[model samples]
Target chain A: MTVSIVVVSHSENIADGAAELAAQMAPDVLVLTAGGTADGRIGTSLEKVLAALDHAAGGDGTVILTDLGSAVMTAESALEFAEDPAGVLLADAPLVEGLVAASVAAQGGADVQAVKRAAEAVRGPSQNSGPPPQREVSEGSVTGQGPDFTGDFELINQAGMHARPAAKIAGGLSALDAEVTVNGVDGASMTALMTLAAGKGSVLHVEARGVDAERAVNYVGGLVQAGFGEP
Target chain B: MVLDVNWAVKWLTLCAQAMAEHRVELIELDRAIGDSDHGENMDRGFQAVLDKLAEAPPATPGAALKLAAMTLMSKVGGAAGPLYGTAFLRAAGTMGDAAEIDPAGWAAAVSAARDGIVARGKAEPGDKTMVDAWAPAADAAKAAADTGGPEVLSVLVAAAEAAEAGAVATDPLVARKGRASYLGERSAGHRDPGAASSALILRAAVGAAA
Candidate 1:
């Protein structure tokens, strides 16, 4: 069983360092890195990264970790080139976490499919708290959280919480003293979970478990179904 | 005989050539369901890889390849850089300082490359990606190689063709993986960028072998 890693970051130092670290720890583990030369350097296109990753995985599957934003896209693109990409996963998990996952996945007789599923579980985006309360995902591998939640409100508008509705929700949430955590649906981060980039008929989980949990959750919920502010 | 430093260089050159040729078409496909840079990114990366191969010609297949991998990860941007880089590097590792490759050695090297791609990408046969092309291509190439058919040529051609067809097959897929997932139902109509490039690489393989 072989293991490989792909790290994408705009920072050349980061990309180089990370690649070095991965190589040091897992010398046998194939590592391929691609990115700009500096801080302001533009990262490579996600498409090219995908091809490179295919080379890494050979024919089995691979584990990928990204710096931010389209880094995930780049990882996803790599999966496209893999043979059993199901074994491929984007390590949102700490670098160590991803390495451990890859090792275990490789040893456990886990095909790229199993690795892909488990890794995706970690890479899967979080949900957001919003008007509609439901979220849909291909599978339930997504995990992790960012920040906390605050309050809620019954949605009261006709059009519901679209971008236009965001001002009210943001304003209401912003007004609260407490920091709010909004999940899109099914405990995923709709805030930017990649999967939730969709528009219209979207539902948000919208958790407000912090100091103003009840109030914030309710406020956001209300703003969601209520169509922001439009009559 | 399988291949040597010359074989390795030639094979990789072919890969770069294939990727360069098909890079655009792949990017167009990606634009529909993905980030739309597959072609352009790969083109940029392979061009860099070719440059590196020229600057420091490796004496052994393995040494030459490690350098290629380094170039991809460093010079190329986006996903293709790391992925293809890893494949070549890993395949080089399998070659293990070989002066030249015998049939089995070549098979092992290509298999290693395949393994590297699998480890890095983690894609499967169906998700409308290059896996569809790679899996069959690898199998077909190996079968052909054992028969004393053109080892490098058979493998590359098989891998490329299988990969391309696999990309086209993606047209009907709903994309269970990658940025295409963001497109959801909207992604179904397009072929996968990775798969398209996979085909081009196969074409290069055939070209190189001949």
Candidate 2:
């Protein structure tokens, strides 16, 4: 279980969403996204960013990808901040591109350098490659009825439950006339839990209720695994 | 009373020696969560500073501080580099022109150093890092300055004690921010590297004054 932390000025969704789109087939590796404007909780704290890099290493070396200047400065600081400066690698490759590539390469059991190449491959030519992102799920679709509502699905999005996703998740629940409570979380607040740290690979419960419960559970569970980005 | 020429040399030597020792410890603690270069980087950076400050015709205390800041920034890498660099720069800014600093001037320099850290770090007390030690130590230095004591060492002792206490207080904290916070549960076991180095810096500062 190796993890890499990628940061961009734009929403992390594009990369994670891209990964989720690709995962329609891959389905094995988990790429975690945290910190960005898309997630309001994110800020340019070199110290905080370094913490994420150290965590990802898991004893093996961890590769870090950051967007532009301050992000680069923050990244450089992380290189200096780690216990074995050699253990934390600051990628010369683009963040989203690198992450998109690493997501697949890592799953294929490629070496760290292979993952780095994957990242470089995805670096959208001169950036500005796609539209910001369309909605992931609509309300009518989320509330589609089938069976009894039993479980909950969590938003494992890195930026926390910020406006877009929260609204998508909440509106779906609202249309269903279901009694939904976001648990193991601050209940639709900005501090949506991203780490999933029951020590990673652990089960976390996000509660939703009423008529739409069944679909919400499956969708949210799927979303958490997809790293919560639009397909 | 007053520091003799030997006393001045002792202060400079003490600051460099303590920084070298603390930088290594800082790296060990940082290994739990951070990049772990605080010790090697600062030690390397400050040694460069000492080389420059040994300039011919030597400088006044304020000029010496400014030279130190420039050397650290140019030589060191990481958050500590810029922040410490700014601290000495600010301390020099506050020094004006003085052959020797009285207790009040020392307090002013400490305050300037604190301001530099706050500005560079943008961190509050609970961030589980350097600010925790720096903020209280600055307060203690200011309070001691008001004592009107004949010995400047009184202010030095007061500030150093406060920083040391602040560093110890970090032991049980679940760090909410900074590199250590990524450890989550793992970060809890060690003392904060930043706080420890901060205490050492203050101890060195006081030792120089004493």
Candidate 3:
């Protein structure tokens, strides 16, 4: 069973919309929304949060992403009062981005803690920042203790390294047992990849290590070569 | 008079009345630095507490407070919901299965409630939040209980008076937490809506005892 996600927001649309977007990226992950009050107002409801937790109880685990001040408080209160709070984790991350990252991680069979880490790691850098720290080994096979596989591929898609392509690459890489970095950012992080801001024809240097290292390299190569199923 | 389940219910009812009466003033206070929904949210939450009380009559003071806690958390629909809900829930936890609360027990309950607010809101006394009122009220209750005299009315009165003074004390300080904190220095000069409501609630407790 994969880890599940719960989105808590003051506005029903925000919670549901974020959940929907995350679900689209991670079809296998269970994304639940506990938004708005019982009377359908723009406020969180403890009953809704409790009910969502109950529904997600039997899963591997549940990670909650909340929006705004009171939503965090409400989610914490629900956890405090929950019958079995052991498997539930509340992530202190932005609602939409955190939910999507958590969902992708959950979809890739990450454990509850890893899923939370994925969500929280989204906050490492805001939308515009320098490239994230990457474990850059070298360009080629070093004295043999190096990446299992490495490759260089040019972006063929007109849009280049955008959100959808980044999600596809990150989602696929996360499922592998390999650690991969492209252009000096965590390859398993969608937002991190988007921050690369690589335009069309920009060459991407990929390095990977682990059992699925070859597959990870080939995965990025194939996706980039195919233009990420785009025109 | 021993504080029992009936007194608990009446205290909650009086809290509702007070919230309804001061709704506009709270709205104005919040309008100055907050989102301006504290009054409406509290009134609606306590109204839900009243409905829940009617639906399921609690057997003891703790049960009543627990019921109110759950209801307020569910119905308030704002930060106040969780804040007040936690306060009531912690107080209920301290009361345990006791059917009647002695003066010392009442003092302990108020202190627990204050702790709950601090833990939930992460606000200190000078933060211009409900903790301002709750902290002094809890201290006053404890002091009154420690005096070792007839304490039923004195404990409630002491708490109410301290809470009122604490609420007033928030007027000149810049908000250090909550939505008002976003206003920075501009948040000064306005009484905190949460502190004001807290004083009103403690005052209602006195009315119930009287």
Candidate achieving the largest DockQ: 3
Give me the TM-scores for chain A across all models, comma-separated. 0.40, 0.42, 0.83
Candidate order, lDDT descending: 3, 2, 1
**For residues A67-147, what per-residue lDDT tens digits would candidate 3 score against the true structure?**
988899999999997888999999888888988888888887777876886787788756524564443454553434867
Which whole-number lDDT from 0 to 100 does residue A121 have in model 2? 38
Misplaced by over 4 Å in model 2 are A1-231, B3-9
lDDT of 1 by residue, B113-179 (tens): 6776676666676776566666666676677667765445555555566556666787888876666
* Candidate 2 structure quality by residue, lDDT tens digits, B38-138: 67766776777678766632457777776676666545555565567667778877876677777888788888988887776677886777788888988
Query: RMSDs, each prediction?
Result: 14.0, 15.0, 4.0
Q: Taking the tens digit of each residue's C-alpha lDDT, what string does model 1 give over A78-131?
A: 455456666566666544334433433333334443443333443334421224
Query: Pick by TM-score: which candidate is best?
Result: 3
What is candidate 2's local distance difference test score? Answer: 0.59
Q: For residue A201, what is the lDDT in candidate 3?
A: 97
Candidates, ranked, TM-score: 3, 1, 2
Residue B195 accuracy (lDDT) in model 2: 83
Each candidate's DockQ: 0.15, 0.02, 0.83
- Model 3 residue A88 distance off true place after TM-score fit, in angstroms: 1.8
Clash pairs, candidate 2, are A81-B34, A81-B35, A81-B36, A82-B34, A82-B35, A82-B36, A83-B35, A98-A119, B23-B39
Candidate 1 chain B minimal-lDDT segment of 10 residues = B149-158
